[model samples]
Target: MVGKTHFIGLMSGTSLDGVDAALVSFDTAGPLTGELVHTAYLPYPEPLREQLLAIHLPGHDELHRAALLANELSRLYSRAISELLARSAMSAETIEAIGCHGQTVRHRPDAGYTIQLANPSLLAELTGISVIADFRSRDIAAGGQGAPLVPAFHAAALRHPTQHRVIVNIGGISNLTDLPPSGKIIGFDCGPGNLLMDAWCQHHTGQLIDQAGAWGAAGTQLPDLFNQLVAHAFFSAPPPKSAGREEFNLGWLDSHLTGTESAQDVQATLRGLTTYGITHAIETHCPNAHEVYICGGGARNTALMDSLRAALPGKLLASTEMLGVDPDWLEAHAFAWLARQTRLGLPGNLTEVTGARHPCVLGAIYPA
Candidate 1:
């Protein structure tokens, strides 16, 4: 069978940073066997970022405007895909379809709702390819937390039988997937990732991310501060639970920060919070995990990685690059694979892992 020459995967994470575009090539044409060929992040214009962050918990009047911005986001996705193709010298005709994760505005699966801001129909109209958007709602409807959907992709992209492996994605909020040899896939939001840390860095210094943990390395990590942040019930909660900025946003930090809190001290403490939260979740769930594959933006942080290693003394911690896959591209690639699943009518959510009532075909597609 001729495989898809291309499929553009679009993702706008909780950090509200930008759209990550991955132009993937797949041999399966089926849902799960896609391979990434080219990937890039098209940053949101500052205006769009502000619009997104504000509308997540929007006012009633903002709902109508939110709809308009959804198209705005779609246009961005369209242009990013167009750019992705142009750089790769591939044309829209060559792309089989596009899988968009959509901008997550609000996700409360426990209450049977997860809204991702997107205009799939417009996206398809604009992009001239089938667009698969809104990938989480169906799972939420099935009595499961419709989030961290990338774990199914992790199971495919990683998962070693000889070793008990854990794939940890430190995005806006940290989430971990335990792909044990003997058990089924299990994953959930561990806690804060780069969201708070990035905000703090932007607040104190002028950096978007803590480069080599430089700023965080400045001050003392308050053991007491670390304990307060990590004690949130989210860490101890069982699988199928998901979270985002709603839980760990600036408000949470403000509550913890004292007037005397040094900028560097806060930075160090936030990094510790991430490292400790992820490490604690790993210990709570997969203490015996021999090796863990790190992905997402946080994996690039040397200090965070070092802290993770120290926290998990006996385990070997490494990035997906160690396994021949770029960490940054993993989640984008997952949506690409998911787009394949939507087109093939496959279940992208694993019921056992996500606690969905039943496996259901995920996502709604819009044809160009």
Candidate 2:
């Protein structure tokens, strides 16, 4: 597939971890074959991360601050693009379009709207390449959750002909895609992933993240706390669902505490909550799924992984790396595939997964 059109994908998930930029090539002669040529990561500066986190909650003069934050994210994205191009030794002119899944500030599909803050037009102007953004709005317009968009990509990229597999991404929020041997695909967010545990660690330990779940592994899980956390309605709800910091943040965790527990115990329970929600979803919906492929930041958590392995006995659990795709960059690559679909006027949303009225091509093109 020489001379295939190259598309760049930029993804910044709710974890507020960093931005991932990947350069992918598509083979036009046959079914879409994505080859990940190069990839790079750009961590958000402390000031910018604080601002973005603040904006998620109601604050003074929010519209103005959010506007400024959007511009800053675009600039950071541009820098990510520059580094990716430098690493790949490819000029911007040679690429087709950039698929940017901007930082999600608010996601409220039940309220009829979702917002991802990034100035795509400014990104196009800065990078001199067309940008495809706002990939979730059209699905929301069609009455859908406008999330877990990666499921469709999982089906195409990771699904096997005879094996029923589940693809789980555990970032700030955890979501999974159910690929049956032969049936429609189903996916939904399974509630908090690192959102609660990371917040707790940052507040008490002043660390950005719990490295390999060491802090949690040192503590013991409070069964009562774990049960209370899992009792949230989001877990038992049907598919076509999604969640964000708005629903499961430190505030929510605080509301559930009795002021007598240790912070380490809380962290361990938070990890238990994540393990429970993810495994519960798999057991409840896709019990036949023999292999569970994990992605996103959670894939690196050794304690979480060990718990998950123990919880789901006799099932194969591994990162997407085993399937030839790096777990860290799968979400970014999905955005690149979504951008390619939009450019070709192909439908990107899967109605079964998002509860949209029908499949629709998702995204707005910001021409350079």
Candidate 3:
């Protein structure tokens, strides 16, 4: 650990489930190796989650509400950090910086703006630690999609030397990182991961999610419904694309539903849509990839995993744990690595992966 530096990463994905905090140390020497020393997940309060989800559309006094929400998120993040340090038996002074990927409320890359609601100044003030945040605006400024940023970290930590591989992260949205044996790394958002399914499941079962997809497994897949769900134009669009609650939320799903099918059947169709979008993206963009590793909340969904395995025959399909990174914490750890990059004045966004004009050092620094 002599040549390594410690950093913490905080991530709250589109699922709005909670914040994931990872305490990681990366080698300052070569190969970009890192160890996941400690990890913690802090679920957002139900009211906070509802408020966070509600702001995606027109709301009363939106600016004041957003500011208040940002402060609340920073407080939650500070709590997670305090817990992460206590759990790791470390102090804030020992950490080089905290990489915080704020909760995204809107992402309209086409309209030339995206918003991740977090007050880094307040976070730094509250935690007494340097913070690196706003990791996306720079990419979007450079005409990139400002998403799927983890692929750069994937290439560093999970890339195989002789085998073609893909890292699929099934957060609220599914994104793929293609690592060929000898070529530029390619990555893009494939579409919905658990957003639609989670929404539907909550509406019907009163559960946060399908719980490893058992609810979905009990229902039959409706081909017509599945086709309709997949017909969304985002799936057909080219790479360098990203989506959010703006596109794949319940309203979008409702537009495709006929109200005649069972709720479980709709869940099954949503599961199929997630699996198909992921495999289709991989096959179309990374046909030679033989090993696929999954990460994020979706990795635990047994029903979704079964569908992915069936869809990608003759290939190895497993979680990123096979490569030493916990599937649940990989993205959080990636942000930790990115914080290292930013602190060292190195590039974080891969031009190839994000379609940026060049590799640029990302994020803003907020001094403690």
Candidate 1 ranges with C-alpha deviation above 4 Å: 1-5, 28-32
> Candidate 2 clashing pairs?
none
lDDT of 2: 0.93
Model 2 stretches astray by more than 4 angstroms: 1-3, 29-33
lDDT of 3: 0.91
* Per-candidate clash tally: 0, 0, 0
Residues 1-368 of candidate 1: C-alpha lDDT, one tens digit per residue = 26555778888888788999998887754545577788777888888887787886647788787898898999999888888887899878888789899888888876788888889998888878888888899988888889779988888878887889999998888888999987777888888899999988977776677887877887878777778887788877777778987788877888876778788888888998888888888888888899988988988899889989989888999998999888888888889888888877889998876789998899987777
Q: What's the lDDT for all of these models?
A: 0.84, 0.93, 0.91
lDDT of 3 at 146: 92
Tens digits of lDDT, candidate 2, 314-345: 99999988998899999888888999999989
Clashing pairs in 1: none
User: What pairs collide in candidate 3?
Assistant: none
Residue 97 in model 2: shift from native, Å?
0.3
